[model samples]
Target: MSMNLIEKDRVATINPLKTCQPLGAMWAVTGISRAVPLVHGSQGCSAFVRYCLSRHFREPSEIAVTSLHEDAAVFGGRKNLVEGIQNVAIRLKPDFIGVITTCSSEIIGDDVIGFIKTAKGELKEKIGEEAVEKIKIIPISTPSFVETHLKGYDNTIKALADYVAEPSQPNEKINIIPGMVNPGDIREIKHMLRLMDIESIVLADISDPFDAPLRPSTTEYKPYYPKGGTTVDEIVDSANSVGTISLTKYAGSGALSLEKKYNVPAELGPIPIGVRNTDQFLRNLKKLTGQDIPDSILDERGLLIDSMADVASRYLFDKTVAIYGDPEITSGIARFVGELGMEPKLVLTGSKSQEFVKDIEKVAKETGAEIDTMIDQDLRSMEVYLKDNPVDLMIGGSDARLMAKENDIPLVRVGYPVYDRVGYHRRPIVGYNGGIQLMDLITNTVLEKYYEPEHWKLQQ
Candidate 1:
């Protein structure tokens, strides 16, 4: 955990691994039922978001942009903002229109709150009473220059808590707050809850909506956003749950806030990437619900244990690795690999937070695996660390491909913005089953490196 090796960020960023905040806000918007995500800034910015989402999720995206021009940037984008709101409302008839501001709008001093308040009245006049009555425009001020996309995701979730959660009789159900996870990871969480016979509200769940089958099921597109999402009704129901289990602090900061305001007890856990973390995750749930750990679930746990024992000596024991990705998952992987008797030599993440380092440090101590960590870092910095402290394997998203190539190491894709690979949105990397899936990938990747065809010398 040394910062002395590389100098802090100065002028230029070489191959930045993270996107701007508005894109994350757009991703968050897709989690709401019948909600249209509208960006109040340059159309290109929104287009890039759409492109990235569409490419990563392999689904059609309907992110609307304000298309700010030179004149609008110079003077103001107030008119464009109003017009864009009216246009999206009329065209999509969305039950809720999520508006996120870009750098352009933020720089030009466009008053999003004032513009939307005025637009609300005009909507009632232009559209029928019934239409405007149900419509809601939520403005998320996400300026790209100030924070990373992960922050945008967290802020938007906080906004949902502020705008939607309400008080009611506390129910047996629970709230699950997931941060910066792909669809497959989310589905695994839902699957685990179902296995425990626990009903949970998964905020910002994109599992079904983002990865719906493309076999032509719907007649036409309505304000019904997509095939699946956490509804406004569900968001309200979160307030009445017995407690909230935030999967990651990045996106689940809202859940903590809900606990503070609504008095719902909250438990914080990192992303359940491996044996130790997943055990903690389910044990917490079992404690909350007071449900018996079903035999079926126990059997799955046994299988994971058996597999870990099999691989410890043969493939994973004493192996050295490097990992970089979202903070929660990066730490989870370190914990998991540590359990497998592997040394996570270098742990890195582009996001900034002191808490991230502390969590990984605990894993380092547990495994007796000495580690160095970097937060608020870039791929360029990761390259420097790799040069100083080389490892056998590298794990991260597509952006780390160059780092892998430079070091001549196999890179296992994980985390956000996995552009080079397909079906990342559908790959489950959490829970007991997810542990098996991950072990298969890593163990085989190591075996593939060790396999020597020349040594086998098959008969010709």
Candidate 2:
């Protein structure tokens, strides 16, 4: 059984793990083809969001801001909103502009939907009705004070479903909602779908846009937006897909919306990070498309199992770890560590989700490992907990780097905002290959710190 700790009363959180909503909204918008995220707030807000994303992905994150000032805050931001849309629509010429609200506009209670309508009409006059109609301006409300970035991503996706998706000609394709995952993870999921020969429309697919290779400017072409994302056409047609699979519970509102509006079957998540979770994903796909699991995938699974067996006793078994990150990702990793015969002593996340506790408890019961779980907590809390009850390793985002260093524990970086390291955005951590990579990383991290020269010699 797991001892789930509720967050104690505090005036404020220290070293809070999650970022704000607009960042998540901006991230989602980047996954749309030729889409630009227009922050409906101050320039500083947009800059922070862009800086955070650019640092993590190691790419130029393009974002626009309304540049709201004192006057706009006191009165209203309708003028700024209309002009921002017009400028972005004309200058950037983006197919979609996600107008994401921040605390400033949200707190003032700006009528964003109405302002968008007004902006559209004004754009019809400036850029012509035909051109204005071509660009879709979706308003996403994301108050930073209310929820974390995960909700921002969820809200943006749901807004897309509400405004864009339509019942159209039927298609055999299924919709995949990959929540807050790296580009490499998205590639892995796509690869698996390709192997299964199942056609899929991955909503907010950021793989190419985020991890795009550097291409020198040529006379023939110069890059603006990188060459990948879910096209607006694909999103509209998503309503007619056979089914929708949301890879994480944190960002499944869009899938749920599609199911409710268009009667599309929806499978909400346990993101496919670990073996059992991946199996569940495959099972869901099979149930939807009647496709059998191919031997190639089975071979990958076999390799993972064989590797686990080989390392279970020597380096992995009975190890203690502290896992923390986004709720769904943390839970999935906790489950995976259990599969690796590692006991997750403490699982913590800054996000407020009761489901996180339930999932951790389920993992504890399944693994027969006594665990301690914390939700809506910060790194400061995790550091305190680790001080009293030390663990062998810590699995989390780059934010935990300091804590791990102080505690002298090996940190296995996973999940979002890993700004301190590069190539993580380019590496898969979801599929069987991801399993092997993570297993190797965890084992090697431990061996590097704890194993002696004699231990290696004996093994040889």
Candidate 3:
């Protein structure tokens, strides 16, 4: 049997592992309060992002676009961008505007920053100095050719940090960068921090806004700007934080850059997915804040350990798994699996970054697990590897789940684009409590397959 089942042609035929860049920028901006994201390119890009987010979050995701036409594409999009910014300003009156560059705009080398500067000038003229001063314009360049959605999210956060944070005297607050997690995960992280008596500012928090309960017909569905996101005031005061903690190393150089620029100390850690990772996260938090772990956290930790002990002998040892997603998420899950005495046989990410590869290597070496790591890898290549060398289970985003299903493999869904399952916007996979939930999901899925009736089993 050959482990090269996926041929070059088949691999070419598979859809890409990563989505378009503008969608990433859109996702980031949606977390902001009363903020409008304007894509500086074609209409389809904006429509696609809105549709995708609406489907996943089960809410209307509002965004604007330049509506690039043949004329704009041929000459320049300056006029369209200026008009689009003005229109959003006049209509939505958002507190801030997040401008994202699309593939077409990047290809044409559109002067997005210049357009924003020009729009700011016009806004000042139209709304007078006082009103214009209150509004903030954040311009993010997301060239699809250069990076994936993961990179886009990191870059946008860095841009936000640069735009709002100023140097200040260090204080007791902590800056928390939770990378691309669900709203529920964000809320849980904040809850855990509060319980530890630690104050933190979580950038782009969207829990309440995105995960609100359904209401009756008479009630109105207001846009989720008034309740979500890190406030502008909070962002301006971030330089005063005593230290910065990033949930995922893949949050990019932005977090570290903020630390250096503001003279704030920094700690890079994995996403708190399972017991081991969550424990490490709590320990780091305690070290940074110089506070003991709270009793509530201890209880949660105890419960997680108890649950793990119950299932460890049967499911934890000598199992093999495959994982693919955003680079940092893949690394975090891979480490968690290894800590449980399982083999992360293959780890893949569509993103091409040195930091991603380095993080994976570091984690794999520490866990003594053999890893086949791939950067900028596509789904086709992953499918090939799966055919060549099968694993006990797979963990990934929606695209990987489809591939897993096609291969008749049981998949534990995590990460972005979890379209097959409901409540993706509220899926919690961080903190001690989150770890237990994730482990339960993984163990139950594995056991369900293992305990299938003999008659129902396939006869090859």
Candidate 4:
């Protein structure tokens, strides 16, 4: 909310908390089986998204684009979008098609929704009524100038739920709206739900898709999309769930939309980063499912506590941390850090969201810790702040890694675009078990710093 804070630097490139919007769209659509995402803009946008996804998921991500050229840009790309959708439908024969507009299309004021309608009409005519009934097309407008990738992802998920969730008789199932999390985290959430004996539906679940097993004896790996993502039928039947659990506040928007349309109730909570947040998520699950917390979860929580206790005297108390990422992620990390008896000195998010300040304030109030919260913050401002007053550690995306290295502060990679490291797609950072993993990572990162060469004496 501090406008002056962002204006401090006009031309400094720092670690960004956010990424491009088209990438977010790609990530979102990856959750759908046989769902081809058609980028309604330049070929570069589609190519860049595919590259990033391939790096993160370690699989070939096939996304179609209108491949806008000079003529399309000047005359408007409506024709390109229409033709692109038709071609993707014919070749891929996907159950659903997601059309996301890029900056180029938005700038030209191309009516994506209208084009989708027209495309649908054309498909109906070509495929006949019966075949048309099998296919669904969803359009989403993602203007990068208006919001970051987080918002774009949120919007895409909301649009999916709106278009796919059907009116059905209620069933004994829970809808799990996991925000933009890695495949590992999604799997962990499903595991926790299974342990609780709660049947749940996770929209766009990509645990298997992004982290499939490697085929031996050959360097060629099969594409992941065909195997991963929630099925279109499952999404349409999500309305049958008893209630919804949203892992992050941003994902709650999609849950809210589902609730409004189908009268399904939703439980909104932060992403389970640290022990306390994970505990909160589990407790909510217990309440919603009318089931008791399993002893296994309790044991996991105990192990996390024991791990922290082993290093509690070392640095748990009076530890200062700086965090930057998506707004919801910043809030979740802030809550988790605060609960660990650490001071979250600086919290920054590139994306602007409603209740961001309120969410941070609530976490600070709950943990009795004061935090400096910033929204719409760029990496330049974050770097400036770090230069002026640094902390013991930083938690964010890959961008923060560089700042941490430069300042000699250890970095905990927590959010999206974790480009430098592998297995980020499968790292679990949610639920009880994930809490244990996170505690170990943080404790080890701190201990690694403690036992550095400078702190040790030369051996005889």
Candidate 5:
């Protein structure tokens, strides 16, 4: 078994592994239909977020800023926030406005909740009671200094559940909370649901909004917003679902909230990234809905196992790999590589969680590899460690490119903010199909790095 180390007393950081919390909150809001994320802080904060999101998704990401001035910082940001919401509602006309608090706003102790209540009254007066009631204004507290982006996403999801969900007669549908994953992952989960003929309400479904299809129209009739996302009605109706399944442990707060409040059975994650994990997810579905595992899914699983068996002795078995990303994804990938008969040398994440340590330990026992786990550490630490004890390959977000380049190891890109390459968001690393793709990706990377030059001599 490996040591799960929580690096301590680090005064300085270089290239931290995670982004700020507000960005996460903004991302969650983007997954909702006709929703606008309004940052209750300076223009620079909002601009930075917009740039990061646009670069990653390669889409026109929209965000509104309160433009808090010096006066507002000293006294209060109530006036700026109210005006900002009014302008966004009247001009942009979004159905939902997620007011996200930044470091500046939170530090000043702004009463954002009170301000939102006040804004509702003012909105009723300005844009009629009926029209104003149609819009939902939810306030999300995301002070960046206190937490990572993962928490921001989780907090926003919980906020959505708290504000929108209303318990009624139970429905035949299940609620799927896909946490902090790519659009492709969500799409794959939806496909699995379809295969099972199970009805589901996916909370914060960003499959359509983030990876939108291009449509040509006249200049006068262009579509301003991408036609995608989980509707408000669906979110409200989620309370009546038979059960809720959260794909990521880090972002399962909403699922837990629903279970506690509305008695909805909640299945917290193993994040169906590998063969076994996917099996667990499907089994959970079968248990909850009394649906048998279909032949199609079984066939897919068989194919994945066949491929792994074919490649294990030559390409994948006993290879060493280091993975870093969000805690859940990192753990999931570690487990997948372990399942492929690979030794996971190091697994690291920026987020601080004891659950991550436990997960890694479990993986270590299952795989029987002495894995070195790092939590709440930056890439600089990872880079420093790799100088002495290098792995055969690295798997993480695009930010780990520098570490891979330095160590002369192949890198398999996955998880959030994969800005260096396009379509990473469009290809999943979840489900049975995702297992096949990931196995191919890893095997190909290994062959390309070590055996590609000798390929011409081999007979097909």
Candidate 6:
């Protein structure tokens, strides 16, 4: 830790973890079956977004752009928006089109809603009025200045619910609205629900789309769309569900709306990153469904407990760790660190709210962790904190590699933008099995600290 590290301005952001809301919108759209994530802005904005998503998920981004230029920025992007919609409809014929705004569109005061209406008319003129039934365009304003990417995801999902969902006969189903976890985490949640024999609709399910397998050469190729995600009918039927289980508060806004409108009970829980949180999630499911906790799951929990007592508890106990990421994941990691009998010296996130901070503080207190937090903060603040307070381990995204190397400490990579590693999308980080896997990472990373390169040379 460098003692010369200076305090940064509170409002200034250096190497921010949270990007604009448009990315969030794009992520949400990716979960809708055959839905195209369209950006009503400059071509460059969409390019950056596509690159970012592709790099992180290791899959095609498949986002569409209106190609708004100088003229479109000044006089509004209605013409470009219409053309973009038409092109997508003709080229891809997506079941749904989710549109998000850029800073340029927001600055020029482009009415995305009006443009959508125009798009409706244009599609009618080009391919007959019945074409509206073939492709639905759902637009939500997501100017980058107002909120972080999480909001964009939440708002777009909420807007999508409003746009397509219709009340129907009660289906006695459960809706699992998970937060910004990877596709693997989402799949684990679904698997658990199936084991419990609970019918569930994972709103905006990205499990298959983001981590899609390489198709065979003879397989048919779908243009600008992936063969995964919750279908349109599933969205409508979610209204008829008996209850809703939101995995994280960050991603619960859309689920909350569904609960209110449909008179369904909503249980907001943690992201299930560790033992305690995963237990809470299963308990919530049990309460809602009145199903016996499967013996297999219980046995899996016992395995987690056995491993913690034998292996992780020995090597990682009393270890000091620094964690930083999104709001929900960081808080979950903090609690998990405590579960391993480790002290989390600093737990921070880029996206913060009073509600979120309070939640983190509560989790920290319950876990008996004395943690310093940076809410709505950046990497620089975290660096300053790390400089002043050294820790044995750092757990976060690839960005934390610099601080870990500088401090001569090991880093356990997790959360978003894990660009330096592979199979991140498929790694389990939820449920009891996921808890075991997470422990595996922690104990392995901690044990690696004792590995001396000098000893390796003597093996010959």
lDDT of each: 0.82, 0.89, 0.77, 0.77, 0.89, 0.81
> Across residues 314-433, which tens digit of lDDT does each residue of candidate 3 receive?
666767888888887788888777766777888888777677677777767777877887777788888878898898889888777767878888999887877778875686878777
Colliding pairs, model 4: none
Q: TM-score of every model? A: 0.93, 0.98, 0.90, 0.91, 0.97, 0.94
Give candidate 3 regions above 4 Å deviation: 1-13, 168-171, 214-226, 453-460
**Please, what's the RMSD in Å of model 1?**
2.7
CA shift of 346, model 4, Å: 1.3
Which candidate wins on TM-score?
2
lDDT of 4 at 355: 76
Q: Please report the TM-score between candidate 3 and the true structure.
A: 0.90
Q: Write the per-residue lDDT of candidate 1 for residues 1-460, one digit (tens) a residue.
A: 2222233465577667678998888888888888888899998999998998898888888788889999997889988889899998998777778889899998988889899888888888999778886876778888888758888888887777777788887779988878778888998898888888999888778777788765554566443457788887888778888888888866677888788889878888877888888888888898778877888888888999999998777677888988888888888988888888888888887777778877876886788877878777788888877788888888788888877887888888877778897887788888888888888888887877765544234323
- lDDT string, candidate 5, 302-410, tens digits: 9999988887677788889999989999999999999999999999999888999999999999999999988888888888888988889999989989779877999
Better-scoring candidate (lDDT), 1 or 4: 1
lDDT of 3: 0.77
Reference-based lDDT, residue 218, model 6:
45
Task: List RMSD in Å for every model shown.
Answer: 2.7, 1.2, 4.1, 3.6, 1.6, 3.6
Tens-digit lDDT track of model 2 for 218-308: 6643367877888999999999999999999888999999999999899988898879999999999998878899999999889988998
